[model samples]
Target: MSDAASRLAEVETNIAEAARRAGRKAGDVCLIAVSKTHDADAIRPLIAAGQRHFGENRVQEAAAKWPALRGEAPDVTLHLIGQLQSNKAEEAVALFDAIHSVDRSSLVQALAKACDKLGKRPQLFVQVNIGDEEQKGGCAVADLAALLAEAKAAGLAIDGLMAIPPADVEPAPYFALLDELAERHGLPLRSMGMSGDYEKAVMLGATHVRVGTALFGARD
Candidate 1:
């Protein structure tokens, strides 16, 4: 019952059987338990085996372990999947509620001046290197429509489109080209897979699937 609650119920039963073979309704895919570099007692047993969406890849190691692990799991939803640094964009908009690498325009004008000096606007995602990987960390498949029109002309609340599809081949044609650039920028979230192709990124519509080593098994 506890290899991190049986690999978090086998990655939530393979993200509910890949959303029932893509008829799509296993809560339409959102399993993001990536807890980077594994601490907080290896992440409090996957938040006592419920795991309310956790991912971190350094905003000071999620400010050195998520404000006392989100003050003992107050519905933890921290994500900042990795690679961001325009002077830490106001400590990643005061610690991540989803910022999956908003790839550049001076880090979207330093996250729109830290969301206008810390009002906070976290759900952005632009990251699309899709396989044009010049050392990855996305934002140039023909510059994703001028980076989503410069992240919505700087008020920035994009709420979709991320990617990582070049490693070891066959990522469903780079998660179907980040689901065809999120249906050509009508954008309703994609944030592609991990842990060896998150059920092919939820059968290629991946509303969000940043799994880590199949729910925390391999990292350091």
Candidate 2:
């Protein structure tokens, strides 16, 4: 097998093992290959491997790469998994099938306005700072109730909650908290976990997992 194919196989094996250990079916967790900082050349092989969902961190970077990959992977689903600024909300709405970092009311309002003007409402997920870290981009856990209320009132379809636990912390508890919050708000998608902790996330009921390095090898 080629280098990319070998990496893909290794990732699949890891995911399957994680799922097995968690006592969950392997298909229950959707793998969102995070292609951030990588070019289309790196992504195309994964696309050919039947990976349909991908995530990117920057609007400008995705804007440049997506069009070039469009012809080769027309049916791929793209997700914007970074902090989306208000000025870029319109483009984000147009570019991604879901925005997984809607952390503030102002950003929600901007996205709503953009969707209203464009007549397209993409799926949204509120990012909760489960670790309560001061430096993170997500909203405080205490603020989630109000944020959920605001998102509901704004007519945004909140699929579920997303979170990044403290890098040094175990992810299971934080993933559980996000699952609980999503249940409280009647949302269905729990987009927690990354390459390192996705199996634990699946056991806790994560509908989606953003995995990059585990699949593509470490980024520079």
State the displacement of the C-alpha of residue 123, model 2, in Å, after optimal TM-score superposition. 1.6
In candidate 1, the residue pairs with backbone N, CA or C atoms under 3 Å apart (3 or more residues apart, or in different chains) clash, namely: none
- The residue-by-residue lDDT of candidate 1 on 1-220, one tens digit each, is 8899899898889889988898998887888988888889988998999989988878998898799988988788998989898998888888888898888799999889988998878898888888887887788888789878887888787978888888778889889888987887788889898888898789879989988888878865
Q: What is the lDDT of candidate 1?
A: 0.86
Error of 2 at 198 (Å): 1.4
Best of the candidates, TM-score:
2
Write down the worst ten-residue block by lDDT for model 1: 211-220
Candidate 2: the clashing residue pairs are none
Q: What's model 2's TM-score?
A: 0.94
Worst ten in a row by lDDT for model 2 = 2-11
The TM-score values for the models, in the order shown, are 0.38, 0.94
* Model 2 local distance difference test score: 0.87
Best by lDDT: 2
lDDT of 2 by residue, 43-136 (tens): 9888887788899999999999998797678898899999989899999998888899999989989998999989988888999988988888
Give candidate 2 misplaced runs (Cα > 4 Å).
20-23
